[model samples]
Target: MSEPKHVVIIGSGLGGASAAAALRERGYSGDVLVLGSESHRPYELPPLSKGVLLGDAEEPDWVREADFYADKNIDLRLGTTAVRIELGGRLVHDGSGGEYRYDRLLLATGSQPRSLPVPGTDLPGVRTLRTLDDSLALRSAFSAAERIVIVGAGWIGTEVAAAARKHGAEVTVVDQIQAPLEPVLGAEVAGVFRDLHTEHGVGWRLGAGVAEFAGGPDGVRSVKLTDGTELPADLVLVAVGAAPRVELAHAAGLDLSDDGGVCVDATLRTASPDVYAVGDIAAQFHPRYGKRLRVEHWANAKYQGEHVAGNLLGEHEPYLSSPYFFSDQYDLGCEYRGLADPDNDELVVRGDLKSREFTAFWVRDGKVTAAMNVNSWDDGDALQSLVDNRTEVTPTQLREADLAGLG
Candidate 1:
């Protein structure tokens, strides 16, 4: 396809906004229109759980300034919900009964926090943190709430526990799993997170399930566990997980992954011609992993956005970058690069795990599949290079203090 005259992007999250900017950067003179359901302009998601919730950062980290859209001649439509995709006509219908025609359409609808299915979830104080509004509401609740009960010990739950504890709120985190973050970070590494929260006075109820939330008119009163124990809670935060927004894609007969994400190839192109998907909603083929994967990390979204733009401009190349993510809780800050399958790999630690200032490597078949650095700085780029290059190194070499040059 020749350079399209106009590109219509749905959803104004980081991926959507970055795609617009990247198209312009790549010298595409085509008109760009970004439709966002949220009123706020594109902002980073990390701060919503950390800085924004703790009142440490008030202003949002915008993807671009207000003038950026105007200067670049990009039409940014906020607070607009895309109701339907007219696949036959190549147009999008918004809730306001407006139709937008496009030479190409990119879906960056992102994902939403999964809601709890139990009763009393609709209570006033029971919340889930996903957007800036949710963060603001929790911040206000945190300032006044004495006892807080967090469901699920995932990244969002764990981070919120840290913020609540830091704000002097009595925090209790409950998860059905034996170790928090065990599924992703593995049992050994997840223990680190458990210790971090425990040291900060955060209560843990592992191998426990929430039966129901009992509350009065004032708000959520307490959470009832399956073990027949009731824990008093002034507020409840549910951090189970997220689900991709793929209704439009599904309705339009676009391919979808088994996990409900829009299915796309390595170039981020959907089965239908002229249609593309990116960000959390896109189950994109990763050349490195040799499989289609949907990643929710901010860095992956940003990279996919830029990479999709190149492909959209006819610079066709596979999206092969390794998965990466990071987190901050208490004084601990960590960055993990590459996809690490704990079941298939052996973890090797470089520094003392007890000191919590070390780099851990996931070695599979004598090659570094992933590396994580906790409370350590200035090694992310090198670690990422090691993964990208598929560097082969032994466990003893990984434990060496001067292992930087070895890889």
Candidate 2:
């Protein structure tokens, strides 16, 4: 067995930390270095826009703390970035004029906020909530703002809506899709969210895209909708989506997708031999389903990171992750298991969409491939498993039978 020398992990998000933790769990005592782009310590990121933004969660609760990483003996580098990756020479260039040498490199740089190329996009009062600093800045602004207009009806937008509403700011969400989270949950489930926000005194503008930004002396004043309506606003949030930060890898002679994301095989291995990609940046090829997927979700990143770490420590295990995502919009919790592709055929499941507490299964042909839920379970205990076990349940039976069997 080859003695593991040094493993360099970029981006100390949940994925990167999970990768390092998994390595330790499997009993690998080599050098593990975690490179974090953010200045803050390693932390959980889900509550940045939700619980933390609403003041129900604290910074101490979010971060894993400095001593934890020290106890683990993982070299945690804060305010550092691995922008240049050299596999042949086994070197990485940091943003702070330093270089790192590694036996194996893990690219967990995650994704970046997708920006809107509008007139007042660079304006002062406008921001997108992705990081802890972004949420803190927006929270400070929320104390004085009367109204906020969210430009996209995605998960981030919905979460921000909940956060702003908690802070007494009148929120309005505008999007091209008819409902919030249209791309992930499909029309049936997204419609539930569409009504969910509206019932809470929030405004919704469906089938409307931002035409242009109108700036004022104070900051951004109003947004010109494509339908010719000028919606007045004190703040604007461009919460459309995220693009993977793979330019450094792509420019360094690595094979990347047309979308500028790292291409990985079943084992999370890129074209480069010693370098592997994980998290939101690695576009993975699904061995079970025969499709290439680039999922920007918490679960995918954590699981993939662990898989790559296991493989790095002489496991040689194949990486196989069931595509999954979850969202906490208002009081309703939404989750999806397997690959919920709307492009596939029929959908059969149990759900009272109006009530907003049920599960829906997506079926293609006669086999059940995917399942989505509102406040569902994540127990893969024996055969009654959920996410990983994609059981074929019929529409009538699913609508009637107790889905708590998933527990």
Candidate 3:
């Protein structure tokens, strides 16, 4: 296809903003229009559950400066929603009846936090943290709340528990799984988080699920568990998981994965010509994993956005970066590189888990498949190199910490 005369991007999160900046950086002088549903400009969401909720950070860390769009002649429309995509005519219609014609289109609609279908979920005190406004409201709620009940033990839930405890609120986290974050970090590593929260005075109710929530005139008053135990709660946060926003893509008759995300090829191109999807909404084919995976990390969004922009400009390259993400809870900071099968692979630990300073590597077929460093710094580059290069090493070499500089 010839160079696009006008490109319209839907959603204004990190992926959308990065793609716009990347296009400009790569010398694409076409008309760029970004449609955002939120009123604020593009900003990072990771801090919402951590520093922002704890009152440590007050400003939104924008992906780009406020004047970046105007300075680059990029048309940015905030507080507007893309309601429909007319692929036949290559046009997009917003909620306000505004129609935009485009030669190329990008979808970075991201995802929305999943909510509980149980009763009292719509109570006044119930909340879910996703955007900056949600975080600010949660911070204020935690300030006045004496007791806080979190419904999920995932990353966001654990982080919120830490912030709530820091603010003197009695925090209780409940989950159906035996260990929190077991699905991602596995049982052994997830135990570290469970211990950290317990030591900090955070309560946990594992192997249990919420039956219902009872509320009074003000809001939620208590939570009833499946085991028939009722726990009092002044506030409630449901952090189960997120569902990708694929309504627009589905409406356009685009191919979707069984999990509801847009299915894209290795180049981040959807089945439709001149159209692509990135960020949490795109389940792109991953060569390393040998399967299509949808990653929700901030780094993945930024990297994929830049790569998609380059591909649109004729720099054909497969999206081949390994998955990476990090989490911060209290004084514990960790970075994970690469993907590994939790059921398979041998996990080797270096350093002391008791001291909370350790690096864990997953070895499969004598190759380092993944590595994670907790409470450590300045070793991500080396760790990532090992995963990317698929360096072969024995169990002794990994456990003895002698694979340094091997990458």
Candidate 4:
């Protein structure tokens, strides 16, 4: 097929911005336009919950310099929301009544934070962190907050607890799950995180649901749990989870997956031939895993964005990489690679778990499915290689200090 004459990308997050950059770098001089819902340029999300919430960074990590798009002759419209997509005519409509026709279209519409389904959520101090503005607002609130209550023990919830503690706020995290990150990291590994936060003076009320956000006109005053227990708090953060932004695609009659994202083939193309989806909103058929999986991590956004650019130019290569994500809470930092289920995989540990320095591997039927290194950066490559290659390893081999023979 002939190269697309014009490419329009909706949602100017990291994935969309990276696609535009890759297109330009690959010598595609086509007309490229990127529509961003936020006023600011595309920025990374990791810093929002870490450095930005901690008040250590004033601004987000930009995916590209503000001048990069202009220099490449790319039309990047900020603070623009795409309202509709007409697949029949290959046109996209924005909120301002502006319409653009394109030879190829990309839906990089990322996800939004899920709000706590409880009363008084709209109160002044009850907030959710998903954007740069949200992080700034939380950072400002944390400065004077005496007691902060975070609903959920996910990455954002735990990270916010660390930040709140650093700001000298008495923090308590409440979650429906029995342990933080239990579903993703399994119980053995999740216990380490729970202990780490506990050691840092972060309180937890696990396996409990939020019945209500008790507050008056002033702001949130306390969080009432399902067990009729109430915890007083001046600030509250609801980080339950996020839902993919797929309204435009749904209205356009696109196919959606059970995972709540736009369904795509192995090449990241939607049902419509010239349309594509990437990042957190894409439920793509992974070639390596042989299943349709949607990843909501930074690495997926960065790599899939660049990969889709090549496919848009007729490269038609399949994305076969494993899912990966990292988190930093206080002095404990860890990186996880691959996809594994706690219910099906057996957990094995290497190095010292007590000292907070170790590599944990999830093996399924003698093959390594996933691995994580906590404060042990040197073994990252070895662990990643094992997961990527589906290397068959015994518990004894995985526990061995030498990783030279794993690959």
Top TM-score: which candidate number?
Answer: 4
The deviation in Å at residue 155 for candidate 3 is 0.8
Give candidate 3's whole-model lDDT.
0.90
Consecutive 10-residue window with the lowest summed lDDT within model 3 = 398-407
State which candidate has the highest lDDT.
Answer: 4
Candidate 2: tens digits of C-alpha lDDT, residues 232-288: 889989988899988778867888876667998888888887788888898878776
Better of 3 and 4 by lDDT: 4
Candidate 4 segments exceeding 4 Å error: none
Query: What lDDT tens digits, residue by residue, belong to model 3 across residues 293-359?
Result: 9999888899998889887766557899998888889999999988877668788888888899999
Model 1 residue 379 lDDT? 80
Question: Candidate 1, which ten residues in sequence have the lowest lDDT sum?
Answer: 398-407
TM of each candidate vs. truth: 0.98, 0.93, 0.98, 0.99
The regions of model 3 sitting more than 4 angstroms off are none
Question: Compared with the true structure, what per-residue lDDT tens digits does model 4 show for residues 171-194?
Answer: 999998988999998887899999
Q: For each candidate in the order shown, give its overall lDDT on alpha carbons.
A: 0.90, 0.79, 0.90, 0.92
Of the two candidates 2 and 4, the one with more favorable TM-score, higher being better, is 4
Clash number by candidate, in order: 0, 0, 0, 0
Which ranges of candidate 1 are over 4 A from the true structure?
Answer: none
Residue-by-residue lDDT tens digits, candidate 1, 255-303? 8888889989988999987999999999988788888899998998898
Clashing pairs in 1: none
